[model samples]
Every structure is written in C-alpha cells, then in structure tokens.
Target: MTWAVLLALAGAFCLALGSALQERDAIRAPGASVARIGFLWHLVRRPRWLAGSLAAAAGVCLHLAALSAAPLTIVQPLGVSGLLFAIVLSALFTRRRVRLGQLLAGLAVMAGLAGLVTLFPHSADSPVLPIPVALALTGCVTAVGAAGYLAAHWLPAGARAVLLAVLGGAALGTTSALARVVAARAAADPVSVLDWLTLLAVAVAVFGGLLQQNAYRTGHFAAAYATLLVVDPVVGAGIGVLVLGERVPTTPFDQVLAAGAALLAIAGTAVLARARNRNPEALRPASSPSTDLVHTTPGESS
Candidate 1:
C-alpha cells in the first residue's frame, strides 16, 4: 500500500510537469481546434512538447502499476496532487511569485486528500468485476462523455471549458478503470495487446488529451485543469463503487467527512481558477497587432 501511494504521487508529479510543458507548447500553436489533426501535426515537431509526452507516458505507466497494487479509492485522490505540482512548476519556470489564493488552494487540496485517506474505508483485496460488467459501465460512461462533448460548444466560454474538462476527466477515469481490470487479468494470464479494453484505453487517452488541449487553448488553464482534478476522481470513485464493487465507509460520520473533503477540494479548485483568471498573463497568448490595431490619420500616426 505504501508503495502504491508512492507510485501514485510520483505519477502525479510527472503528469503535472508534462501538462505544464505541453500547455506552453500548445498555447504557441497556430490553431486551437480540438478536432483538427493539423494541431497535433504542428505540436509534434516541438521538442519540449515531445518531452512532455514522454513524461506523461511515464506517468501513465506508474499510474497503472499503482492501480494494480492498490485500490482505486486510494490512488485516485492522490492524483489530485498533480494540480499542485503543476502550479509550483509553472511558478518556478515562469519565475513568478505564487499567490496567496494558490497557496491556500494547494493546502485545501492536501487537507482534503488527507481527510479522504483517513476517513474512507478501502480494501486492497477487493475482487475485480467481471468483464461483462466492466464493459457495460465503460459503455455507459462513454455515452455520457460523448453527450457532454457534443453539448459543451453551446455553453458560454468559461462554462464550455469546464464542461469539456469534465468530459476529459471522465474519459480518463474510465480508462483508469479499464486499465485496472486489464492489469489484474494480465497478472493471471497473458493478455493480448490488441484487446478491446486496451484499444479503448488508448482511444480514451487520445480523446481526453484533445479535450484538455482545447480547454487550455480556449479557456483559462487553471479553471480547466482544476475542473479536471475535481472531476476525474469523482468519476473514478463512482465507477470504483458501482463497477469495481469497492467498499466505502458505511457510517454516517465517515460518509459526511468524505463528502466534506471532496467539497473542500472542489472549492479549492474554484479558488485557484478564479485567481488564475484574474491574472492570466502568463498563460495568455501574445496579442497580435492586427487584433489590437486602431485606425488613425497620418498626422495622428506621426
């Protein structure tokens, strides 16, 4: 269990670093369309972006190993640490001072995580759900995510970013669940690389990545990333309980504490988002003269 926790934390750090690096690259790209293949084609040429991809891949491997060793409940919340790591990394790389709100947000997230770890009841030995059940749940999650993606465009800009982020988080959570099952199965027997679940996981990762990049392009990074941090574990926890049959504390006090902790984490994310939006120059794209050009007479120009 200790090893699992350590791996999850390490994975979170890697993911945060990767995301920050990728965001830097993505912001400088010519186009921000989520469905545009050309966007990736442009980004792939950047060495920093490629390095970030490698880091993210490493994180995924670590995350998978952690999932196989421990229960989802334990691993998922720890993944929230990625946001903190990202904020710190951004500050260091940008040589900017961290805001009080950001610091408080980080503390809130950590406190919430600690509360969850202490109050929630998790069993490391829970049996994996049958393949059929997992498939059904995955299908349902995919359908909902698809619906969310389709509906996101109609929303206002900020809301749209958040909705897309939530959908991305859902995709990631579903992929994690599928990965956990595949890892458990592979432990007992050789699993095919071309298995449906494996392919599904790959598809989800791609979809989620596209959504995240779009969010970073179209909205404030803090808002989108915060939404992702909050939504991913929530979706993961639901799947963990319904599909994975993981047990939670049945006591009312413990349930309340867990709920409070979750809310705290979410509220903290909201704070961070607001703070980031207030001062977003670091993440904002450079303004083009054409966009800010004003017509004037020749004398005025002189």
Candidate 2:
C-alpha cells in the first residue's frame, strides 16, 4: 500500500510537470503536430520542444506507476494539480498573464476537485463480466468525444480547447475507472493481468496526449488547462460512484454542499468558456487622418 501511494504521487508530479511543459511548448509552437514522425523530429530539433516532450513522457510513466499503487478514483482526481501547475508555470515561464476572473475559476476548479476526491468511498471489490462492460463504456465515451470534436466549429478557439479538454478528461477518467476494475478482478489470478484493461490504458494514454495537444493548439492557455483539470476529475468521480459501486456521502447537508461545489466548478468552466468564445467588440476606427494640418503645414512645405 505504501509503495502504491508513492508510485501514484510520483505519477502526479510527473504529470503536472509534463502538463506545464506541454503548455509552454504549445504557446511557442501552436498547431505543430507531433504525431507525424517528421514533424516530431522537426520539433525535437528545437531544445524546448524536446524538453517538453520528455516532460510529457515522464508524466505518462509516473501516471502508470501511480495506477499500480492507488485506487483510480483517489489518484485520478489528484492529477488535477496539472491545472495549477500549467497556470502558474505558464505565467512564470511564458509571461502569459491570467486575469482575476481566470484566477477565480482556478480556485473553483481546485475546490471542486478536492471535495470530489475526499468524498470518494475507499472500498475494493471485483466485478463479474468486466471486459464487456468496460469496452462498452469506452465505446460510448469515444463516440461522444468524436461528436464533440466535430461540433467544435461553432466554438471559438478557447471554447474549442475547453470542449476538447472535456473529451480528454473523459478518456483519462474512464481509463482510471477501468484500471481499478481490472485490478480488482485480477487480484486473485496472476494471469488476470493480461486483460482488456491494459489495451484500454494504452489507448487512453495515446488519445489523451492528442487531446491535450489539441487543447493547447488553440492558443488559450488558461482555458485549456482549466477545462482539462476540472473535467477529468468530475468524470472520474462519476465513474467512481456509478461503475465502481462506491457509495457517496448520504447526509443531506453534505450532499447539498457537494452539489453546490459541483455547481461552482461547472459554472466557472462555463463562464470561462463563454468568455473565451465571445469576441471583443470591434475597436473604434482610428481618427481619420488629421485634416487640421493648418498653415504651419504649408509653411513647412515651403
């Protein structure tokens, strides 16, 4: 248990660092696709891109380690630290400024994320017929993500990033959920390790990476980070309760408070998303070329 905890923390640290580096690189090289080997090679030629990629790789490794040690519900929410890392580091490293509203949004994300994680039940159980259910859930999540990505045209770049972040969040969240399921089911058999969950994890990691890249491609740093940070946990929490059979707190007051926190997080994300979508009003045309040149102009010409 102690080892598992350590691994999960390591994963979180790596992911947060990777997230910050990814944000910085995205700002510096908007819309550069690293999927193409040639394009990836092109980026690697630059030290910054290479460093960012390395950080991201480290994050992936850490996350896997964390999964080995901790429950997905507990560990996945903690990964929301990426939002704070990206926001603060972006300001420091890239000199990108965050507005007061954005700061408030960040706080909202943290509050909600922390509350949700603390609220998770600490129980372990294995499920029957896990593979089919896991695959079905994955398919449904992927379909929704595809639809959202296709519908991004109606949104501005910032909103687009947020929406895409939601997809990434869902992907990772489901991965965590499935991971726990796999671990529980296979706890008794060594051979159980070789199951559908491993393939799902790989798919989740790959797609999650691409979605993150897409989020950064839109040139809105805060929105991209906040959306991913906020959505991932919310999705994970839902999976914790729904799929894992973990019972949420039953007290009326506690339930109310949790609901309110969820609302705050959702509201904050929506406000930020809308603000990002709303274009600034057109600037007043510059004063017509000065016509009052006056007699001084004629004398000067002479």
Candidate 3:
C-alpha cells in the first residue's frame, strides 16, 4: 500500500513534468504553425515533446497500477497533488524563483480539488453509462469544444489557454465515462466494442487531446494546467451524480462545500492567469522567443 501511494505520487509528478516539458517545446514551436494542425507536424520532430508524451503515458500506467493496489478514496485525492507538482516543476525548469502567489494559487487548486473529490468517498467499481447517455455526453463535449475553439481566437493568450484547457478537460471526462461503458461491454462481448459509444469516446478523446495541445501553445502553463485539472474531475463528478444516479449520495451541505471548492479552484486559476506584473514573464508566457530547446545543450534551460 505504501508503495502504491508512492507510485501514485510519482505518477502525479510525471504528469506535471510531462506537461511542463511539452509546453517548453510547444512555446518554442512556431506560433503561426501552432495555431493550426501543422504545429503537431513540426512538434513531432522535437525530441522534448516526444519524451514528454512518453512520460505522460508512463504516468497513466503508473496511476492505473496504483488504483489497482489502492482505493479510490485515497487515489483520487492524491491526483490533486499534480497541480502542486506542476508549480514546482515549472519553477525548476524555468529557473525562476518561486513566487508566493504562484505557490499559494497552486495550493488553492490542490486543496479545492482534493476537498471536492474527498467529499464523495467513491468506490473502486466502474459504473458504465448507458448508450444514450454516452452519446448525449459526446454531443455536449463536441458542442462545447467547437465553441471554445472558435472563441479562443478572440481571447488573449492566457485566457485562451484556460478556455481550451477547460474544454479539453470536459471532453476527456466524458470520454472516461464512455470508456467505462465500452470496456465493461467489451469484456462480455469482445466484438461489441465496435459500437457507437466506443467510437464517440475515441472521437472525443482525440479532439480533447488536440485541445490540450492548443492550450499549451498559448504558453500560459500554470493557468491552463490548473484549469484542466479542476475541470476534468469536476466534470467526472457531475457525470457520476447526474448520470450515474449518485451511487454515493451527497448531503445538501456536501453540495455546498463542493460548490465552494469549485469556486476556489476557479479563483486559483484566475490568479495564475493574472500573474504579478513584477514577474511579468514568469507565469504570463512559458517559453522565450528563442527556440532554446533546439540550440541549448540537454539539461540546460527547459
């Protein structure tokens, strides 16, 4: 169990570091190309982003292993530590002094999300959504993602990053719900996984991943990452309650606390977005104009 906890923590760290590494390369990529799908073509050639992807994949595997070893009540809350990990990793990679506000904001996000999930005390069992519910969720994700992508062009870089992250997170959450359904059915009927629900989940997951990349390209790492973390579980919890028939019923007081936690997470994301002017470039933008990843030696300047 102790090893499981350690692995969970390690998974969080890997995820945070992976995002930081990916952002480092994304920022240095051509903004003009990044604004389009072409940036992926350009980014795939970068060693750093590939390494980041591998790290993220490893994190997911580790997290799954931890979940198999531990309970959801313990594992889910530990996920919040990823936000704190992101703060530390970003500061270390950027070689910037950690600002009080950034640290506090990260804690706020972590605490808010931790509180929000801990209130539920969910079980490890997977509750699959019905096909109709899965399709509806997919439609909602599609609509929201399309709208956010269109609106993103008009917003400032920081705000754009947060918006895209939220969209991506929501879509991914929906994918998770649908995935449970698909997996359960696939186990009983191996060929049944080729249904519409599985297709929808795959589509939403792909679109969500693209949205995540767009968020990174905006170069507001903390705000975007925190927002994504907040929205993903929030959306998942919402589906669990509203769609899954509240297997773990909450009291009215619990609902209020959950709302408060959501607000705190939002506030923290705003603080990160509006980084102190004195350290204007610290959280404001991720990478410098120079493509340091290309010229600088390895282990020098994230």
Among the numbered candidates, top lDDT falls to: 3
List model 2 lDDT by residue over 115-228, tens digit each: 766665656556443667778878888788777755654565656777778898888877777766667767787677687777886777566656666566555556666777
Task: Indicate the residue-level lDDT of 97 in model 2.
Answer: 59
Per-residue lDDT tens digits for candidate 3, residues 148-196, read 7777776766677788899989988887777766777888888988888
**lDDT comparing candidate 1 with the true structure:** 0.68
lDDT of each: 0.68, 0.62, 0.75
Where is model 3 more than 4 Å wrong at Cα?
A: 121-132, 276-302
lDDT of 1 by residue, 1-302 (tens): 99999999999899888877787666666532233435555668999999998998999789889989988778876877787787777666555677777877877866775576556555555347665776677677668877875665555445656677878888887777777667766776765435777777777767777677756654356667777776766676667777778777699989999889988877876676556442243234333312122121121100
User: Cα-based RMSD of the predictions, in order?
Assistant: 6.9, 11.7, 5.9
- How high is each candidate's TM-score? 0.77, 0.71, 0.85
Name the TM-score of candidate 1.
0.77
Worst 10 residues of 3 by lDDT: 293-302
- Global lDDT for candidate 2? 0.62
Residue pairs with backbone atoms closer than 3 Å in model 2 (clashes)? 4-69, 8-66, 11-62
